[model samples]
Target: MAEDNFEAAPGGFIPGPISSGRGGSGSTARTANSNTLLSEQDVALAAPQADAVPPVIQTLRLQAEATTGVTRGSVSGGTTTTTPVVVSLANASTSDRPNADAADGDAYVDFGGLNGNFNAGSGEYLQWSFAVPAAGTYDLAFGYAFFSASATNRPMRLEVNGKIWDRLFDFTNTGANTTYSEAVTRVYLEAGTQTVRLTATGFSGPNLDYLEIRSADPHRIVIQAEDLLPAATNTTATTVNREITLPFLNGKTPAETFRVGAEGDAYLDWGSEANTLDIPVTATVAGTYSVTITYANGGTTGRPLTLTYLDGTAIGTFALAPTTAPTAYPAFYGDLVPAVRPADGSDAGDVPDQSGWEGWTKSTLTVNVTLNAGTTVLRLSGAGGAQHRQVRVRAGGGVQARAGRPIRHHARQSHGGREPVRRRDRPCHRHRRRFRCAHHRGLRGCEPQHPLRGR
Candidate 1:
């Protein structure tokens, strides 16, 4: 089962502002739907506070209904609106549909509804003015729900202080509208009152709960699968942002799975040897760090993979273990034991289904890597078959080596490459032959004469 506490977006937590095509009902019926969106609260909105001599502010939350000012129609002649309708989580029973759950408080703003349960149309918008304590880049997120019948990719335009930040800010399917997910974007705010607005583009926007502002962590960087450099990507790699339905329990019933807990709810399906991902990353600290990758490998065995720097320095080589069995459901769902289906004698709906890609799972593995401070590209290559979501690099104690040995300081070579002047445990390959360096008085290995010459 995917960890219920999993909250990081698949495309790193702060994937700038999103603009994409990813392809949403009524009200009692609208009320029930909104209530359902509340129950599946995937992330905890309560920010953790570190104890200190003085209490420090952890997160600043602005409720949509309380803080937002609504406006409709043309900006020049739009009428000042009243407080938006705030919906509360419904009390549900075992027989009722999922009850609504709120991340911060009890109620959320009904951005997609008006009057009562009636559907809202385009041109309606909600704006909020909040004060920032400091001037810096912060992670901005919306706790929202969108469960509709006709609309899917309900687009919104974000304007900061009347300046358009993103014209097509995408709010992808959060599986069930009742299932609330945090959609994050990065923004630079000066320490003062800043106005932020979200207006529907073509369709009604998602039901919003609140807007959260938090400090960004420079030591950690997350790269979503869709954010992989297109110029550096292989043509064979395919990116998807939708729900997948597959057979379960001997094909008796079909299961619908979304990239739950994923940023943008998307993943990259590895196609072939040509499918390589070049991830752009910025390291705040230059040192050895650990990279935790969220990926799904459905093969029977592990898939071999190699991580390297853009210049071809090997970070590490390892295999990603399979996240699930190849079977569609039940039999293919590994050792999961759930209630049997009363009619078919198969596993009940309690069994976790494969969520994304053909065999996608929200599993993660951490590997150590050495990175230089500043912007750089990390490359992933090897035999294909694993679906990847997010790669999170965090500063900490980890391995520091280019190949399989520790990196040692040495004088710069005439070729501009810094040779590793460390003693080799075993004989070095011809391309990385060992030599006694006179300048450093230590063992050093020279780079291969040709880029493709070394083994």
Candidate 2:
């Protein structure tokens, strides 16, 4: 038989021996969750911020004549006889009186809908592309010239990322020799590379001057410890498989830890003396702010630490005071509930209030450190003990990360039951519906001595 090429679809590949509901040589096979969310893998846990600023902005301004970031049609918006030409405001001639930024030789003329009949589907007429610093809503504004001689209720369709913008309006000729940005449209955009397309319709639109894409007022972004991209404790995970992760636990019952996690469902850990955690953080703006490290120290002595190489460069060391209990505190349930036990445990119940767990002698620690825009790290010596759950970074802090966000650190199942079965085995708490490892049932690519797996 000729060999066939096998490939996974955008929805995803569901590998299974079960096949479909039926069986046989000609029987149909089974596929699970066939409706694939192609973009789910790309979605990041947006560190939400308070909508404070009236209209704080990160603007990307593009000059029309600069043809690199744009796609175009055969003609620009104006009269066809005008040659869809590039006008220099320096021209003292009174033909196409350029205004605003245009008055200074910074506008496109005789292009787009010069004759009022724009080719709607051609290259989106004109598009300006720029990278969005972060994902959020933004206002789209433009600088262009308008004149009554070439005007006929000139309607222009503005689009961001191909979607027609509701801010479409007619650039009624403002009697040649004038620029208008009186119309401002708002649209939501995603982070990363994006495009703002302009299409002329219903009439010839104004000659282009410049395109401005400005993000809403600046707000705080929270980088939760739970959202770090999955990986081996020290190395980046390259493939989509069981992450070489440390122990993870979360939730109300059956999985209780007095060490209250960020919000509630994020209780991940790392205590090895020498290991690395590559945290993913997208700071919308570049500025200095107090970064707080949230972790639990169930021990009585301090955990030695060193601050080194954030985002890659080496740095000096800083020590944090040990988080120790003021006095001896007895375990709530006689030390049965891991190092951290619920503050309130009902031993009488079959499951005991796994909802709450804290170390009888444990305490939460918050260390405030200064971090610049990108690149930061925390080094550990593991001298006393190093166990942390989360880290919170913010500037005008008010709200914390909302509870129940997808967690990044995960536990790969172990075939041989050697490690703590309590947190790792609870299937309910580990798998994420959006994106997950198919080998989670029987984790692969893991060594026998993997820190969070086999004994």
Candidate 3:
């Protein structure tokens, strides 16, 4: 019931849902595929300048206990302390937690780890102070655990610079109580040290581990479903129930279990057409973009929806096919198979996943649209019943990257000294390549929607 208390700052931004099986630890690294949708002339005209400077992406990781102060609150009686790390991390000393000799050689601040096995009760909080070289919006990731006996959610309120950012924010289960996962959100910060506080909204909250902050990618705009503006009466922001089992790792007796939903256990249930959403997007670079919606449908057929500009100009229409499975664990989670460590112990690049569904199979639908520089609004009207987690708007032009590897946008072969452009959802005469969407047939700068990594 705590989710009913959803709140966001005035004209504010939130985060995606619980991100266990969804992807990496809310990292900015994304998976993209080559798109040959534009002609050679269009490609040459829209390509990035060779001398253009890359945007500086800022990142920081701070241990929870490493904060300037750890205070004990008297509201509900709770305490905080440092405990051994419970989850595997890329930078961790060891991958094994249960069998590890000593806490993975790292310790995390634990809320209520001393006074009780639960989190700090309502009114108790943990605060972190850090300095930023740039003034901009940054994504915040809280590494935590909430494997309660009740299997219920633990809600907390995120405060940035003494102002509430997200009220009643929560996370999905971490598979096991000792295991950990990251819940992400967004906050705009001015240059210099800023204080962030997480206060329990429920009787208690998830255990504290560490907090990671990174400058939001300028080219990729991620809009959380919960952050939709002009909140509709029928729309509800909440989480769903789903079970995830990780791949069978070598030397591990029982494999790890991954939970479903976006990073912060947040999503929007589009109740019906009345629950239409007005989404705000800030594009640093003016151009065409591919808007990918991460969603799930439990029905047997596709869920129809329409995307358009504020003035009612059609951007695209999608009938996302059903992603539900009859089984307890859907094969859709199998998309994460490539992320499993190989037998040779070499890194598999930690590919992010495409599993955002809760119980049902997770899926994505993308539409291409053009925009000018600055902020804009897009309207989304749906037949309803779809669980939308997040929307990612990516720059449309240029040679796209996939799994962090660069690939050619156009085929090697050419015709009449011009690279043949391939239209999405339609087979090309020369290349015979087709993509996913078909609604953007007449739209300029339209391109095929590339699938996410590990899918």
Top model by lDDT, which number? 3
lDDT of 3 by residue, 1-455 (tens): 11111122222342222122212122221111111122323222221112112224556787765635334342342233233223333333443343222222245543443345453334466777788876656667787665666545565656688754544455656766467777766555667888887765433566567777775545666655544422222122222211112322222333322334333334555554333555556555666787766666756777776777766678887676776321112112223343332221333543232232433223334556786545565666655546665566767885244433344245667578876653323343333344333433343343333332122
Worst 10 residues of 1 by lDDT: 23-32
Instruction: State the lDDT of candidate 2 residue by residue for 1-455, as single tens digits.
Output: 00011111111111112111111111221111112111223222112232323234556777766658866654343224232345665552465543534543455644544234442212125677888765555555666656554233344545556644322233444455465543344445556888876554324456677767765322233333333323223232212111211133222233524343222223334433333443333333334444344444655555544433333333333243444321112111232345344443534543323221222112222433444333333322223333443333444332222121212223656748655333333342333311123545354433232333421
User: Model 2: how far is 434 from its true place, Å?
Assistant: 56
Which of the numbered candidates is closest to the native, going by highest TM-score?
3
Superposed by TM-score, candidate 1 places the C-alpha of residue 207 at a distance from the truth, in angstroms, of 0.8
What is the TM-score (0 to 1) of candidate 3? 0.45
Clashes of 2: 28
Better of 1 and 3 by lDDT: 3
Candidates, ranked, TM-score: 3, 1, 2
Q: Report how far off residue 232 is in candidate 1 (Å).
A: 19
After superposition, which runs of candidate 3 have C-alpha atoms over 4 Å from their true positions?
A: 1-58, 67-105, 113-120, 223-305, 308-377, 382-411, 414-455
As a whole number from 0 to 100, the lDDT of residue 220 in candidate 3 is 66
Q: lDDT per prediction?
A: 0.47, 0.38, 0.47
